[model samples]
Target: MKKIFGLLLVVLAVFAIASCVSEPAPKKDSPLDATVAYPPKILEHKGTAWGANPPAWLMEALKGYKFVERMADYQGKIVVIVEQDGESREGAELAASRLDAIPRISTLMGLRVKDTFAGAQVGDKDKIETYMERVVKVASETRFSGFMMEDSWWTYLQTYTPEGKADKRTYRVIQLWTMSKAALEKQLDSILKGEAANEPKTPEKERAIQAVQNAFYEGF
Candidate 1:
């Protein structure tokens, strides 16, 4: 009887294996008349003007979602100059003076004057130069030609109140400026698509700005 039971178990196992082997796989979709839809192409444009505060032409050119810069140029094509917010003003000022003294500084660093984001107490001269070189290399690969300090240098100075809270204000002005500009640029982008009235026209010099804007925004 034990021998018969063992034989029966062996027979069931064979049947199970055979059943699994006989099962069919799912069919794959063939190339017959089936249509596949793809995502739409996004428009690319420079973000020089603040998005929310975008010049009329800029907003129009960028009909789709567009990336723009705040601390740098609006479209990442222009460079911006910045200084610390009041905490690291000293370092920023020092760097600016250094740059002015050495016009070739940008070339040495592989950066355009517009691309350098110098800050205070961020690093020593050698370190700053090295950092700028790397920054320029990377920016060149992207949409930017160069960048400059957009930080309000005056703000950095004002933070040092008469009460001697200078130490508390220890921050890299240029780095902070870069970050702040990026944030503001994003904020402005949100408002780019919405309708807003044109910026007020002003003096002759201001009128010249319109022509530049026309070129930038119109591109024709």
Candidate 2:
């Protein structure tokens, strides 16, 4: 049977601001490392994630965060989850990092969606059931471009005290746009009608197309 409907797909990878751990206070013979705190301060903080009220800060911090699937209100386009690369250097510079991130992430994302979506027709429309394989290609042809930011959180290999520091950098969740259900269905319909796919496959098309397929059943 020909399955037709709208759907949103996403890839969820947890990331956090990078931090590292430190050693105890310095010994008489060895000085403490500059990156590590000379003296450590411990906290008595004890908290549970559930069964109780969450702090105001936690609530506030998560206020704008939403799964890409929930943001259909922004536009009819399908949402593709992507990871925005964040760089950690000698200093913290969000502005510059974001600039570098756009193109870098876009290139990596292109490799993912280069093929878009595809569909195959099987059985006759009069048959009780039908099977099909489908492929949908967008960005290269329809100018599928641009992306939105999604929720981001910290990730750590191991837990640490408050002052712990690590070499990891902050990572972000990127919301990439693809064709909407109506739009994707239209692609399949065109295929069924024996019509040509989207035209003028652009030489530069990656930022938009790669995401939808990997996250979706036929998107790869």
Candidate 3:
């Protein structure tokens, strides 16, 4: 009977120990968890230069306009340059109003004014050209109607030197543009079929035609 009581006491002690012991707390997902997937690719492009070939007449019209640095299209919409400064802003507003008044252009696609900083220092001429090309390519690929330029300055520790002084530099100016994918596809179709009857046959004409085609297909 004593042995039985001892065994019962031992079992109760084991039960008590098990009850007192706690299971490990559930692990929480970290705020910077890598398990989360990246967002889906968006149809948009951005750059420092224009991508689409504007009509010859439009090009001539834009001449002598220093504020109008670059222009391009997002789908059917005309993306115009908008200098964020007071003078440029006023001009952009006037242009926008006038564009809204135009039946032919406005009816087809509305205008989009993209703000830019004039005094930005972007490397040498070659680098600037390359940057513009990249922007235009991105704009075409992404099918974005408008983009804005943002200047960013930052200071970082110069660890290369023994003193490790704080160094400041203009990190970069980022341009981001986005447009509706559906709108871009629709405009591309219209552009491809608009003048099919009088399609250019000359090499220059063919190249021009190819440029628009590539904007839709190759996105550059």
Residue 219 in model 3: lDDT: 26
Candidate 2 — which residues are off by over 4 angstroms? 1-77, 88-119, 123-141, 145-180, 183-220
lDDT of 3 by residue, 108-170 (tens): 222210012112222232323333333333333333333222121111111111222222211
Q: Residue 215 of candidate 3: its Cα lDDT? A: 44
Stretch of 10 with least lDDT, candidate 3: 152-161
lDDT of each: 0.29, 0.30, 0.29
Best by lDDT: 2
**Best-first order by TM-score:** 2, 3, 1
List ranges where model 1 is wrong by over 4 Å.
1-67, 70-73, 80-91, 96-168, 175-220
lDDT of 2 by residue, 25-55 (tens): 4334435543433221211111212223322
TM-score of each: 0.19, 0.29, 0.22
The lDDT ranking, best first, is 2, 1, 3
Q: How close to the true structure is residue 5 of candidate 1, measured as C-alpha lDDT?
A: 36
